[model samples]
Target chain A: MLLQQIINGLTLGATYALIALGYTMVYGIIQLINFAHGDIYMIGAFIGVAAVALFHQNFFLTLATAMLACVVLGVTIERVAYRPLRRAPRLNLLITTIGVSIFLETFMTVLKGPQPTGFPTVLENVTLRVGTLEFSSIQLVILLVSVALMVGLQFIVKYTKIGKAMRAASEDYDTASLMGININRVISFTFAIGSALAAAGGVLVGIYFNSVSPYMGVTAGLKAFVAAVLGGIGNIPGAMLGGLLLGLAEVFGVAAGFSTYKDAIAFTLLIVILLVRPTGLLGRPIQRKV
Target chain B: MEQWLSSVIDPYYQQVLMLVGIYIIAALGLNLITGLCGQLTFGHAAFLSIGAYTAAILTRDFHLPFILSLVLGGLMAALFGILLGIPVLRLTGDYLGIATLGFGEIVRVAFTNMKITGGAIGLAAIPRASNLINVTFFVILAVAAVVLLENSRFGRALKAIREDEIAAEAMGINAMWYKIQAFGIGCFLAGISGGFYAHLLQYLNPNDFGFLKSFEILNFVVLGGLGSIPGTIVGTTVLTLAPEFLRFVQEYRMMIYGLLLVLMMIFRPHGLLGGVNFRRLLRRRKQKATALSS
Candidate 1:
């Protein structure tokens, strides 16, 4: 029973980690919490649903379409909404993101209506038994896809030229710009990668839960954001660890019959972790701007 | 006065005014903390909920007088404010925001699960004890107090901290203590506003005070001009009245608000009154008058 719950927790945690990666990366580079990132994730799920329902695409094709579309949408949003306010106060940029989030959610609602759409059964749910433990095939698929994407991300960040630029910009943006790196291109690339990850996470969530809604991103975004903060807001590895721990904690809390407080569990962890280690488990100490 | 108000104006308008006044009071508190103090909080509505619930429970169960319950409710929220403030002292900027957001969610969930707070169904049968006069009196009191605080040595210290925290510390200001005090006072005002809000509705629900409501209050503070009293009032009044004016486009209200927020940030992050600097503007006018006369 415990093992089953742990698998379920890992499946959920994987998606959160995907989303948290976006948050941590954006915060790492620009120092702005992209409130609209969750909405982008929501849009990805809708695209996935549309792909399956309208175009009759298979699972991989649908997931790929969602991710590709999100990359475009994410880049567009940065170019139009965020680029002009590059020199404004961080608070103003934050508010602009909130505004964009609100607009996207409502616009989607207006277009698709407010009901949650059921994800088509692209893959059959088949339970597997190994040594007195039972797990579903969907869990395995989610785990596999998540691992593949995260590994790809790790490679890009560790080895790619743009990844090196990203590291430099996150370290010191002004110096990076002075080093002849195009800051705009780097920021746009960061958004593109983050949005793709979030889209993949969104699709995986849709596949796992078999449901997609316009408002699904609101709570999930918040929790993923918490996950990012828990790992240390700008630390990619920290976000991953934080997401997994949060998932396990929530699953166990439910197992202990505290399902009603499921939402609270993430927030409680957020407050406790923030109070104990404001820099997060893996984050460097913050240098307050003069 | 009640009789006269009723004779002179419709009860509907009076109720609208009451709500506006309550929001003004709430926004004033937010202005003090987020606008003036430069602490970006995302859970202010949580404080309001604490006050509303406390006042509602007191009036419904203890048979306490309306004023007493209202004051006690404010105190309760202020107590929570202080407690929340103590641990988050080391955190600044976005970290503090997320922490407050977490705190807000925790408070909401706690209220949702607690039987005494009526669970998710929320407390009902709250006496409709507060009236327009009560709301008016509190609004006037809150505004007066904030104005006084803004001009005092304490207010100057807060502005100094907002402008340059390191510099403020170098100047011998105790930044930590002042932050907690500002947070306490801000929450206190939100509590009283919640107290009024509860009696006005005579019903309470956990869902009423959500993250969106917090955003709505933030919109008011930002739109009016951060740290500016007239700006806060203008922002609240305009935003409060915007929905009514746009009732024809009810569904588009949120979309428009979202667009406006983005545009406002891009074009005028200082807000409508943020750069107005009323005292300086008035002083310039006075100087012009003297120059013309001479």
Candidate 2:
């Protein structure tokens, strides 16, 4: 029973990590929370549902389409809403992102009519037993896809030229620009990749839960954001670790019959972690220059 | 004249005014914290909820009078503000915002699950002791206090902190105490506003005081002009009244609000007033006209 719950927790955590990667990446580069990132995840889920229901696409096609759609949307948002305010106060940028998030949520709500739709079963649910542990095919698929994506992300960040530019830009944007790197392209690429990951996570979540809604992103986004903060807001690997830890904590909290307070657990844990280690686990301590 | 005015004004208009008055109080409080103190709080509605519930329970169960319950409710919220501020206030900027957001959610969840708060069903049939006149009186009082405080020595200390916290600390200003006091005062007003809100609506739902509502109050502060009292009042009045006039676009109201927020931040980060004194605008325009004529 414990093993089954752990597996379930890991599956849930994988999706959160995917979403958290987007948050951490954006914060890493720009220091903006990208409040609308979660909404992008929601839109991804809706797009997936539409691709399956309307176009009769298969699971892989739906995932790809959703990811593509979100990439375009994410880039557009960065270009139009956030890019102009790049030189503005951090608070202004933050508030603008909240506005962007609100717009995305309301726009989606208007289009989708605010009803939770069950994801059409594109893949059959088949349970597998391996040495006293029972798991479903969907769980395995989610795990494999998430891990593959994370690995791909790791490779790109570690080896790719664009990834190098991203690291340079994040380290010192002014210096990066002075060094003749196109800051705009780097930022846009970051949004594209981060948004794609979130989209994939959204589709996986929709499939795993078999339900999707406009507001689903709010809670998931917040939880994943907490995970990001837990591991360290701007650290990619920290976001992944935080997501998994948060997921396990929540599952254990539920298993202990504190289901009603499940949402509170993530927040409470975040508060405790913040109070204890303001930089978060795995996060480097910030040094004040002056 | 009084008879004619009373006859001319309808209950609907009164209700709208009452709501505007309530929001004005809440927004004014937020202005002190977010505007003057330079702290961005995303969970102010939590304080409002505390006050509303306290007042409702006091009146319903303890048989307290409306005024007494309202004051006590505000005090209760102020207490929570101090408590929440003690730990979280030390964190700066976005971290503070997240902590407050967490605090807000925790308060909401506690309210939702607790039996006395009536769970998610919410507490209904709250006494309808709140009205336009009393709400107006409180609004006037709050405005007076804020304006007076803003110009006073304490207010200057707050502005000094807002300008440069490190510098303010170097100047021997107790930054932590000021922050907590500002937070407490801001929450006190939110609580009082919530008291009026509950009695006026005669319903108290934990859902009403979520992050969205907090965002709405922040909108009023930002849209008006940070640290500007008149701006907050005007912002709240215009926003509250805008929905009524734009009833045609009620469904798209939030979307429009979102767009406006983005646009406002981009074009006028200082807000509509641009932190320019309104009185100076007319004079500047006149001076420009005079120069053009010359």
Candidate 3:
């Protein structure tokens, strides 16, 4: 029973970790929370829904198209909402993101109506049984895909030239610019990659839950954001760890009899963690420079 | 013309005016926290709920006097604000925003789960205590109070903190104390507004004070210049009345509202009347720019 719950927690955690990567990457690069990232996740789910409805059982093609759509949407949001506020105070950027989030949510509501739609089941009958342990093939696939993506991302960051550029930019945008890295392109690319990951997470979630709604992103995005903060806002690996821990805590909390207290438990944990270590578990402590 | 005005404008228009007055007061209160104190509070609605419920319960169950209930509600909200601020105000920016956001959700959830608060069914038939006279009077009173607060030494300290907290602290300002004061005052005003809303609407529900309402008030402060008194009033009025005026576009109402916000942020990043104070602008204009010496 414990093993089953752990597996359940791991699967849920993997999804959160994927989503948190998007948030952490953006925050790491720009120091902005990108409040609209959750809405972007929502949009990704909608795009996935459309792709599934169109492609009908062609899982790979549907996933590709949804990711592509997310990339475009993410880049556009950056250009339209964030780009203009490049030099503005952080508060303006925050408000703009909030406005953008509200706009997306309201627009989605108007377009799709306020109802949870049935996600098309492409892996409905695929169950794996391994000697007293039962698992859905879809869950296994989601776990593998998420881990693979994270590993691929790690490699890209460590090995590729663009990855090096991103690292330099994140370390110090001005210094990176002095070294001839196109800051604009690097930032845009960062948003694109983060958004693509969120899109992928959205697709996996839609499949796993067998349902998607306009507001699904709100809570999930919030939880993922909490995970990122718990892991340290700007730390990529920390975000992953945070996501997995939050997912496990939530799953176990629900599984252990207090289903309704899951949210409270998660938030309480966040507050306690923050109180104890404001910089987060993997984050560097930032001291006030006199 | 006079007869036509009285016949068409007297009934619902008066009610709209009353609501606008109440919301303007509420938005002004929020402006104190987000604008002046630089606290990104996504939980103003929680305070509003506290006020509304306090008044509703007091007036209904305990048979308290209406004015007493209103004052008690405001006090209760202020108490809660102080409590929430102590542990949480140590955090800044997005951290503060998220914690307050969580606090708001917790308040809503608690309200929903509590039996005396009527659970999810909502408290109904709240006595209507808000009329045009009382709303308008309180609007003036609230506006005057905020203006006075803003111009006072405390207000300047709050502004200093907003501009740069470290600098403010370096200058010997008690950062935590001022923050608690700002939060308490903001919640007090929000409670007052909530009391009025409950009495005006004759109903109170946990769902009614959700994050969306908090965001709506935040929108007012953001769209209006932060820290500008007139801006808050103008932001509240324009935002509240725009949907009513654009009622013809019912299907596309929210879309247009969203578009307007985006456009506003893009074009006037400081807000519609940001930076320059209304009084200061008029005084400067009256001085005639030194007649353009060139």
Candidate 4:
């Protein structure tokens, strides 16, 4: 029973890690929280559904379509909403993100009426039993895909020249810009990649849950953000650890019969973690320079 | 005369006006924290709920008088504000915002699960104690009190803290105490507004006071102009009344607000009025006109 629950937790945690990567990456590059990232995930789910249900596409095609669409949307939002506020106060930027978040949520609500739509069952649900623990094919697929994606992301960030540029930009924006890096392109590229990951997470979540709604982004986004913060706001690996821990904690909380308070658990843990270690488990403590 | 006035203006308009007044009170309190003190609060609606539930529960189950319940509600909210401030105020910028947001969510979830607070069912049939007269009286009183507070020594200390925390602390100012007090006062007014809100609606649901509501109030302060009292009033009025006027696009109104918030921040982060003190502007204009005539 415990093993089964742990598997369940891992499956849930993998999706959170995917979403958290986008958050951490965005925060790493630009100090903005990218509040709209979660909504991009929501839009990704809708796009995935559209790909399968409307166009009768396969699962990979659907995922690619959603990721591509979110990339466009993410880039546009950055250009239209955020680019102008590049030099504005951090507070203004934060508020703008909230506004953008609300805009996407409401716009989606207007497009698709406020109802939870069932995602197409593109993948078969075949459960495999290992001892007393049973694992579904969908769960296995989600876990495998997420792990592959994270590894791919790590490769892109560490091995590629663009990745080197991204690292330099994140370390110090002004200094990186001074070194002739295309700051604008790098920032846009960051948004694009982060958004694509969120979209991928969204589709996986839709398949796992079998439903998507306009308001789904709000809670999921917050939870993923909590995951990001738990791992330390701007740390990549911390986000993964935080996501898994959060997912396990939530499952255990439900297992302990606090089902209604599941949402509260992430937030409470966030507060506790923040108070105990402002810098997340994997995150290096920031040196405050006078 | 009262009967004639009632006949001329529908009670619906009165209700709208009262709601506007209640929001004005709440926004004013937020203005102090977010606007003047430069603290970013994303869970102010939590304080609103605390006050509303406190007042509603006291009046309904305990059978207390409405005014007494209202006062107690504000005090309770103030107490919670101080409690939240102690640990939370240490964090700055976005972290502080997230912590408050978490606090708000926790409060909301707690309200949803707790049996005494009516759980998901929420408190209903609250006493119809708040009306236009009392709401208006409170609005004026609250505004006057805030204006006075802004000119006082405590207000100067808060302003100093807002400008430069380290500098303010270096200059013999107890920044933490002032921040806590500012938070307490801000929540107190929010509680009072919530008291009025509960009584006005005569129904209290935890969902009604959430992060969205907090954001709405924050928008009022931002749209008006940070640190400008009159600007908050103007911002709240324009935002609240514009919706009623554009009732045709009522569904799209929130969408418009979302777009406007982004655009407003991008185009004019200082706000619509650019954080200008209107009273000072008018006096300066008058002096210029006099000098030109001479």
In DockQ terms, which candidate is top? 1
lDDT of each: 0.90, 0.89, 0.85, 0.88
* Model 3, global lDDT: 0.85
TM-score of each: 0.96, 0.95, 0.93, 0.96
lDDT by residue (tens digit), candidate 3, A15-36: 9998999899888888888878
lDDT of 4 by residue, A1-290 (tens): 89889989999999999999999998998889888888999999999999997656488989999999999999999999999998887777877888998888989899998999999888888989878779999999999999998898889889998888899998999999999999999989989998899999999999999999998998899899999999988888888888889899999999999999998999999888877776667776765332
Docking class of 2: medium
Off by over 4 Å in 3: B1-10, B278-294
lDDT of 3 at B161: 93
| lDDT of model 4, residue A104 | 88
List model 3 lDDT by residue over B1-294, tens digit each. 434644767867877887889888889889999898998888899999999999889998898988899889989999999999999999888778878877887788788878999978999978776777777888999988888888889999999999889999999999999999999999999998888898989888898898778888888887887778888888888888887887898867877787777777777788777865656877887677666553
List pairs with backbone clashes in candidate 4: A231-A238
Query: Which window of ten consecutive residues has the lowest lDDT sum in model 4 chain B?
Result: B270-279
Error of 3 at B104 (Å): 1.8
Q: Quality of candidate 3's docking, in CAPRI categories?
A: acceptable
Query: Which is the better candidate, 2 or 3, if ranked by lDDT?
Result: 2
Q: lDDT per residue, candidate 2, A6-31, as tens digits?
A: 99899888899999999999998989
Instruction: Show the lowest summed lDDT stretch of 10 residues, model 4 chain A.
Output: A281-290
lDDT of 1 by residue, B98-167 (tens): 9998888889889999999999998888998767888888888998898889989999999988898989
